[model samples]
Target: MNHLGDAHLRNWTLRLAALLAADTQDQLAWLGERELETKDVVEEVELLCRVSEGLAERGAFEPEDLRDLRAIGRRLGEIDATCRVGLWEYALAVDPAWDDIRSLARQFLLTRLGDWRQPLPRPVRPHTGDH
Candidate 1:
């Protein structure tokens, strides 16, 4: 993936970790209400949530844990691209004029990636509209 896409995925991974640290009921309720733009997003979130719950129960991230998290990040990056494509399709279907709205939504999603502390390998720059 490109740099921005990779950063977004890393951001999402951090966000997932934050969610895992939060209350389970709150996380479930939040996920339940989100208007995911595609089936891939829904599936990815469910899968990640399950994994996150498991990891939380284990109490710490080991080498294998980091590997699992990296895998999740890669998968999320794939799904994120798919979701964006789906969004574009919907935009085209509804009205081409909605492109600006779609752009804003995409940016918003990127921004929502979370405020968790940076994870390993390399640091992710804060998302600040540079993309």
Candidate 2:
């Protein structure tokens, strides 16, 4: 297999990032505004899973990265179920803020899966005696 160049990797990464951001925004927006049924959540989960599977097969990501993507899908599945429960129990009265929570969670999951490295944690400076 040929090694990917920096430009190639960057292009793919940026494209995937943009796609994810848009997808998350749309899904979360809907989730926030409506009390979705079980069937609705299931369909969304299926769509996300299909994308994740495609990403895994692209070979741009490592094995661990694939695992992270799958894990995110699973966790989102749980969140979808929770939303369904809330819908069933509260009807339209259910708070839509769950959209923000799920959106943030999706961002976290993407950051973990993406190859963008974070800066190293800052080291603690030695304490000075000055008050």
Candidate 3:
């Protein structure tokens, strides 16, 4: 693997973390209707895993880059789990009936975010150490 800059790794981690937080917010909002399901959560988790794994596989990244990605994944998982539990509270707050449409909306938003964060097919790698 190529050596990725520390700055690059940090930036990626921060970006992923932010996205995860945003997704959690959206998810909770949808869960207000009691539309959340185990399948939905699993899909979100899979998306996160895929993105982290892809970043690690990028040939330009160093071990540190992968490590940073793993750290971000850990944080994201925590946020996701918390949001799931909070979903019940949110549903109570809204008093909305959980329905199939609400569940679909949640899944759609998460899928969109995942697609947005997906790395390009070909990543650009530095030829050598920075000048």
Instruction: Give one digit per residue, the lDDT tens place, for model 2 in 82-111.
Output: 555534214223534344434533464456
Top-lDDT structure, candidate number:
2
List, residue by residue over 89-119, the lDDT tens digit for candidate 1: 3423453223332333233333444333222
Which candidate leads the pack in TM-score?
A: 2
Please state every model's RMSD to the true fold in angstroms: 14.1, 15.1, 15.1
In order, what lDDT does every prediction score?
0.42, 0.45, 0.42
Pick out the ten consecutive residues of candidate 2 with the lowest summed lDDT. Answer: 115-124
As for candidate 2, its clashing pairs are none
| Candidate structures ordered by TM-score, highest first | 2, 3, 1
Q: Model 2 misses residue 122 by how many Å?
A: 37
Off by over 4 Å in 2: 1-38, 60-62, 77-131
| Model 1 lDDT at residue 82 | 39
Better of 2 and 3 by lDDT: 2
